[model samples]
Target: MKINLAALQIASVLALGGCTVLPPQPAPAPRGGTATPAPKPQLPAPPPRPAPPQPQAPRADAANWRDLPQTPGSWTYSAESSGSAVRFGQPGAGPLLAIRCDRTRPAIIVQRAGFGTGTVPATITTSSTLRRLTATPTASAAQNAAVAFEITFAVRDPLLDAIAFSRGRFMLEMGGAQTLVLPVWSEVGRVIEDCR
Candidate 1:
């Protein structure tokens, strides 16, 4: 019998083809038990912080005059030829109240145009002091045109200077029940000092 080379090659190829490739498999479970689960990742915690401080409310009757809001009738100051004039209301145009002071004289002028004319009782109060006075209206051509009547009262130099420099609510009570509060700021002290 003669052996064929082609028959031998075909037999080798068929023998190799009989072996098949397979995918990888997981490890088999342990005897009588399931596989363990993988662990989850965790982040580190942040450090704790302290709380901020809270602001306290101001007490009643406290010297909080600087914190008060400026109204239309608040006191304002201006330089004059003789001295300084601390006024309330529109300057130059017509002021409701004006305190004109010089080295020689001190006068408190209250406009009687909007306020009723004649003798009116008025009180000025500060943080610690109270001054009661009477305002008498006088007629002048200048006063009549602008304020109708001008109420004039003489004020002492020392008292006027003290009031201008004080840091408190300088309240003026007039017209029976009407009250006007003027918050005296630090700038007012500078103005009064410069005038002197």
Candidate 2:
């Protein structure tokens, strides 16, 4: 009546192997309704990112109140013949620029010492104004007081007044020549008044 233990264990294992196991299933939906899905576990949200930087306007420089692009150099201004003519230059050098009054013609003649061929445009810049005028080569070096070019303006030209009353200084740009930044002085106003 005694049974083999090994054989009995093997028979029980073979019997259980034939059966299948599965996870629990969800219930069917009711008539005319959809089945809802199972809920999922929730997770915490991540930290927020920083905002981008905004553009800012430029700040004013107190040290350079004038806001000049280039610093001007020291110059000397002299009026000759009671403002009939004015010259601007270094104290010890010949005149770099001159403005003369032609009383007979009632015109103002501006002259610069530079070498250029033919006629060219001269650009004048002041704090609040800019003007471009035609400059013709002087007919004779000796006749123009050794100047190479000249710009003639009517006695009542507004540019004359602008140069006289310019802020601190005015700039003169000639083609193929060095630019000159001349200081505004009493001589400039005097010449304008005399010409007018």
Candidate 3:
């Protein structure tokens, strides 16, 4: 008997379409046939890891540090050093600085921070305290220096060079406060910061 070529080709094309070409496989003879199990895949080993570079601690900027937030009725102050602390509070980071100068306190206490960073740099700060132009025959200005009060702050950090301040002997100049700034410097110390 001759097989039909058309039938054979149609069966082959249908098989190529992913349909099973044969019927369900029957069980092997119970008495004698041996079956080989499929092999397991062997994964490639991961490449060896390169040695990690040495870890270094991040350098902190002292003058750039910030401390506590401002409280109402109290002046805010911050230093450039991490080691620096104010009687009022700690130093912190900010462009606009706020310093509370106790009218009763004689000297600026925060200078201690500048000293620790090395010899604190000298600075020229101006005050807006109104000063009379001295009683002059031809002068219209006041006799006393009537200008807004501004004081200089020596600094170890260039970032804290400019000062923000409030003046009071328990009484404060609510709106108009003086500002201070430091001269250009070579180096500013690292500011201490709180992690928590």
Candidate 4:
């Protein structure tokens, strides 16, 4: 029938505490006003990678030349009216190098593709010895219509000896560039002997 005053006071205090209001939020800026942009995060740059190594051409040295591996079935021999010729290439194929011998004339001829018209001075090195030679591009003809160049030199005993009997490399330099390295084998020596 009767309420406690202290309990009523406590209930009133609890109800007022529950109705407490939060602080008011700030108003949005006007449409014409410029807003400050947040700062962007920074990142470090990636490290650079190293370049790959390039392939190198073989060096012109006696050890490298003399130690050339023999290409099986590359040397060939043929008969001619002047004398016998030794053809260096695969069997039943066009010759790369032809050593022609005759009582009247003796010479070594080298043939390669992609030669333009003109004469190119060249060097033939056997071991440490070197011989200067001339290379002439083959003429365009109906019978031999190939774009190629050839180097022909008269056979020299010293050059042959160094190529056939020495422990050195043999290289052909043309157009100021070393283009070919010749391999010497026992058969090469035999062919040279027969020509002699």
Best by TM-score: 2
Which 10-residue window in model 3 sums to the lowest lDDT? 166-175
Sorted on lDDT, best first, the list reads 2, 4, 1, 3
lDDT head-to-head 1 vs 2, winner: 2
Q: Could you tell me the C-alpha RMSD of candidate 2 in Å?
A: 18.1
Residue-level lDDT tens digits of model 2 in 1-196: 1468888888999899877687788898878988888888888898898898786422121223235443243434444554478776656776778888878777889888665556877888777677777788886444324446888999888888888888887777776456776778887778778867
**Model 2 ranges with Cα > 4 A deviation:** 1-83, 140-147
Alpha-carbon runs more than 4 Å astray in model 1: 1-70, 73-75, 90-94, 103-114, 140-158, 165-167, 190-196
- Per-model TM-score versus the true fold: 0.45, 0.56, 0.19, 0.51
* Candidate 4 lDDT (Cα, 0 to 1): 0.62
The TM-score that candidate 1 achieves is 0.45
Cα-based lDDT at residue 15, candidate 2: 90
Alpha carbon deviation, residue 101, candidate 2 (Å):
1.1
lDDT of 4 at 194: 58
**CA shift at 88, candidate 1, in angstroms?**
2.8
Regions more than 4 Å wrong, model 3: 1-34, 45-73, 76-86, 89-156, 162-196
Ranking by TM-score: 2, 4, 1, 3
TM-score of 4: 0.51
User: Relative to the unseen true structure, what is the C-alpha lDDT of residue 160 in candidate 3, on a scale of 0 to 100?
Assistant: 35
The sequence of per-residue lDDT tens digits that candidate 1 reaches over residues 102-145 is 54545544443434445667656566566776655454334334
The local distance difference test score of each candidate is 0.56, 0.72, 0.29, 0.62
